[model samples]
Target: MKKGFILIEMAIVVAILGILLSISYINFTRLSVKSNVDSKADEIASMLRDTYENGNKEMNFKDYYIEIIKNGNSFEVSLISHKNSVRKTDLKDFELNIVGQTFESSPKYIYFSPNGEVFLSNEKIEEGYDYNIDDKKFSDIVIKKGEKISKKIHIDDMPLGNITVD
Candidate 1:
């Protein structure tokens, strides 16, 4: 046997390195995509939670709610008070699945009261009760970043609703 490696051996080594590199690249891509999806979901959840928790502290009488709507290629999450936007966040590269029925071209909404109640409609907020609160009217907001990756933001549609993400 010669001291140096043959041409076939060199070719095999290069091919193996290329294969490994490709695999690593693919894995990195998948991880990056997953990270993006998770990051967006967390951002959304935080926005909703912050608004729900602190919104009524300043103006207890003002109705506070979150508006989530599809805006072209991105989604818009706006915290609304007295029919005006308090804060807005725009997210890209995802889809928002509103489990509850939207009100006639209006955005999906989660209204909050000073008493910690959550409602899908703000129309009946001042009436002191939701029009329908049968314990099964929970509205789900699902954010999906592809066919395989997704996150759910469950907003309990009841007297005292909690915002949670996963």
Candidate 2:
């Protein structure tokens, strides 16, 4: 017959709500980190694909290369256009990092042939040099010739690892 809950009931309700909110906040943070990682990977892949497609056009017969450089916990991906001094510029450059993720390989320099083939400067995709984002043990990230650019996330828990490029 009570019109309002007693103090004990109100406290219990507040506690339950707090617990639910904490859980939701944790999940949200985890998803946010995963989303950020996925977004960065997708951006890199897109840039690579664009470079490959544009190189295939043979516009002015210029050479295009995607340069991956690692400095400390961060890495950068840049599109280098080899042509006239004025025309030579970085099409896209990005510096990103995920707390504890490490790159199990060294810096990679991928060249895009005018014929749309993707390969390293050595003309071959080097093994044991794939990027390991989030330390999920993911491998084989070389962009193969005539293959679509794609990446997958391997996050299974919260607090993703920092990135390290060898």
Candidate 3:
């Protein structure tokens, strides 16, 4: 009686395993890309909220603004501060990348007043606004004075069509 499997049988088993692995790898790559984009969006929203909340604090409050700059496949988030010097200088400008994503339109700058209100440059964001990317409208970040800050992601034809951030 034979005590071991034939060479042909071993090769067939290995080939089957390889095929299954390749299929799984493809699916995982797609899911991961989607997740990265979603998380980056969330981070931007959260940063805006934090800046607003901390704007009124007396410890280190000095007019903070967020500037989004896009260059090809990468986007940068800049944290800028306006100092009341003799020259009215902009100080402490820090920038970071969005990673694997780019803005659909030109750069946008949002300012947070000392009273914790949202503003586009010097004017307040009285009505709601939509942040579009790649020519697709993803969500609306509403900024109404004397009301709670809220955000909603519109998933019309997005990659993750079922995702909604509230």
Sort order, TM-score high to low: 1, 2, 3
Candidates sorted by lDDT, descending order?
1, 2, 3
lDDT of 3 by residue, 32-92 (tens): 6555545555665655554544454542333554665545544565555442211111111
Which scores greater on lDDT, model 1 or model 3?
Answer: 1
Which residue pairs clash in candidate 3? none
TM-score, candidate number 1: 0.72
Runs in model 3 with CA error above 4 Å? 56-62, 83-106, 112-166
- TM-score of predicted structure 2: 0.55
Q: Which scores better on TM-score, 1 or 3?
A: 1
Off by over 4 Å in 1: 58-63, 81-87, 102-106, 121-137, 156-161
lDDT (tens digit, per residue) of candidate 2 on 1-166: 7598899999999999999999999889767655555565655555555555566666422355556666654566666565312121221222332223344565655554333334444222233444322223232242111132223422222222211212
- Candidate with top lDDT is 1
How far residue 135's Cα lies from its native spot in candidate 3, in Å, is 18
